[model samples]
Target: MKLLSPKLLLLPMLCWVQQAAAQQTTEALSDVQKIEYASPGVRGMGKPRGIVVEYERLPQFDIDSKSDDPEIGNGSARVRRHNKFSVRALAPIMNKPQTKLILGIDHSFEEFNFENVTPATYSLYNSLEDKNLKSVGLQLAFLHSPNEVNFYLVRAKAELNGDYTRDNINISDYLKTTIDVAYGWKRSPDFAWGIGFQLGYTFGRQRVYPGILYNRTFNDKWGVESIFPANARLRLNVSEKTLLYTGYRIEGASYNLLASNPPLSKFNDIELRRTDFKGLVRLEQEIYDFLWFAVEGGFRQYYRHRVFDDVGSRDYIIKNDLAGAGYIGVEIFAVPPRRFTEGRKNK
Candidate 1:
C-alpha cells in the first residue's frame, strides 16, 4: 500500500501527545504550594473555623427570547431574581493531628418571569406564567494538609429541587449528588491554586399533564423518564478565602408534550436536552475572627435541543438558543463563639 500522507499519519499521534501533556501538566501543577503571608490568625488549619452565613441577590433583565419564529415572537422582556443563604458549621470530626472534617448546608431560590409582547399565533404562544425554582444542598468535606508533601480534599454534596413555574404547575422534581476530590501542593499560605475533578449524577422526573386541563389526570403511558447527568467544575483559589470557579453542566430529559402542542395532537411526544456553561469570580474578606463577607458575579450560556416523534416517524423538531442573565451577590460569614475565641487566643 502507498504510504499515507505525513500530515494524516501524524494527526492521531499529535492528538494523543497533546492529551497526555495536558494530563501531565494538571498532575504536576496540583502539588505546588500556595504562598501565604504573615497574618494575625491561625496559620496551619485549612478548615473553616466558624459558622458562615452568606446571602446573595441577583436581579437581571433580558432583551432576547429563545423563539426564532418572528411572527410568533422575536424578542421578549424578562426578569430574573435569585437569592441564596447558607450556614456552615465547622468542627473536628476526627481530632487526629493531621485530618479534619467540615460540614455545610445551603438553601437558594431562583425565579424567572417572561413577558412576551409578540402577538400570539396558532403555532406559538406565551405562557405568561412566572417560574420559581428552589434548591437546597448539604455538603461534607474532609481535608488533610500536613507539612509540605501532600494536600487533599474530598467532598460530597446532595441537592433537591422543584420546577420553575408559578402557574401551580409542577413541571419536574430532581435530586442530584456530586463528589469531588482535589490534590494540592503545600508551598506557602497566601496564594494557592490547583486543578480538580468533579463527578455528579442527577435523577428526576418531568411530569406531563393530559391536555393541560385536569390537575389529577396523570398519564401513565406518557410518564416522565429518568436520566444520568454528569458535569465538571474547575477550581482556582487566589487566597485562602477567595475563589474563582468555572463549570460546564448538562441535563437530559424527555417530555411527552411540547409547550405549544395543540389540543388534539397526540403526536406531541418530545425529548429535550439542555446544556450550560457558567463562570464565576468571587472575593471574600474577613471582617473579624468570626465574620466574613463576600461578593460574586457570573454569566451563563444555555442551549436547548428538542426531538419529536410523530406517527411512528421520529425527527429533529426545534433548537432554541438562550443567553443566561448575569448576576452579582453578597455573602456573610458567622463563626461560632468558641471558634472566634480560639482564633483570638492564637493571635
Candidate 2:
C-alpha cells in the first residue's frame, strides 16, 4: 500500500489543533472577569484593571530639507527631538456587569532646534529661529462592551498651550476642545478593529513683527478643527497592551492684520495648511503590579502649503512637498490603587 503524501496528511491535523486551541483559550478567558482598570485612559474589553501613567521622548527628522532651496540654508543635519509625558487613571464606577469611567491628564513639551551653519552669513537676524512649545490637556471617557458585537466608547477632551517661543519672541497661544465616539467589531479574542470620528475647535492668536506691523497684525483671531485642523484614526490591537495605530491629520490657519480695512486684502492675509500621515507601533511590558514600561516609534510625512496675497499685484501660493519624520520614545507607567496607599506602603 502506498503512503499518503505528507502535505495532505499534515494539513487536517494542523487545522484541528488550531481550532481546538482557540476554543480552549476562549473558554478560559470567559471565566476571567473583564478587568476594568487595564488601560488608564481608554476603556476596552479584556483591559487591565488599575491606574497607569507614562512618559515618552520622540525625535523627528526632516529629510527633504536637503534639496529644496539652495539659498535657504540647511539648518540641522541630525534628528530633531520632541519630548512627551503623560499620566492616566481608570476606575470602576459601577461593577456587576463591568462598567468604567476613565480620567486622564497628558502633558507634552516640544522643542525644534535647527543646525547652525554659515554663522556669519546666516546670522540670528536672518536665519529662522528655533521654537519651544508646551501643551497640557485632560481627557474623560466612558466605555461599554457587552460581548463582541456590542461595544462603544465616548471621549471628551480639552487642551491649552502657552505661546510658542522663538528667539525670545512669543509666536502664538492656543486652546482647543475635542469630542470622539467609536464602535468596535471583534472577530475573536486576539483580534479587534474599530472606526472613530473626532471633532475639535481651536482658538488662537498670532503675533506680527515690528517691521511687518504695517502688513500684518500683532494678534489675529483664528479657529480651526475637523474641517481645517481635524484628524481620523484607525486602531488595531495585537494583544492586551500592545497596539498599532495609524492616522491622518490636517491643520490650517489664516491670519489678518488689524490696521487694514477688508483685512483679507490689505493685511496680505495668509492661510497655512499641513497634512500629516503617521503610524506608530507600541509594546507594553509590566514592570511591577502597578507599574509598566512602554516603548514606541512613529513615522510621519508632512505636507505644507501657504497662500498669501503679495505686497504688489497677485496672490502667491507655495507648497512644500512631503517631508519625513521618525521618532522613538520610552514611557514609565505608575499607578497607585488608592490615594493613601503611598503613605501606608512607606510605613
Per-residue accuracy of model 2 over 1-347 as CA lDDT, tens digit each: 00000011111111122222222122113556632211111222112334444444445444223213334333323335444444444443443232445565655544334443333333211222243234456666665555534455566666544323343332332344556555554443333334444443211112210100000111222111111123333444454434443444333222221112222234433332223444565555556645667676677555442323331113433333435767566766553433334343243
Q: Candidate 2 has which clashing residue pairs, if any?
A: 37-48, 37-49, 37-50, 38-48, 38-49, 75-115
Q: Highest lDDT among the candidates is held by which one?
A: 1
lDDT of 2: 0.36
Each candidate's root-mean-square deviation in Å? 17.2, 18.1
lDDT of 2 at 249: 38
| Candidate lDDT values, in order | 0.37, 0.36
TM-score, one value per model: 0.50, 0.48
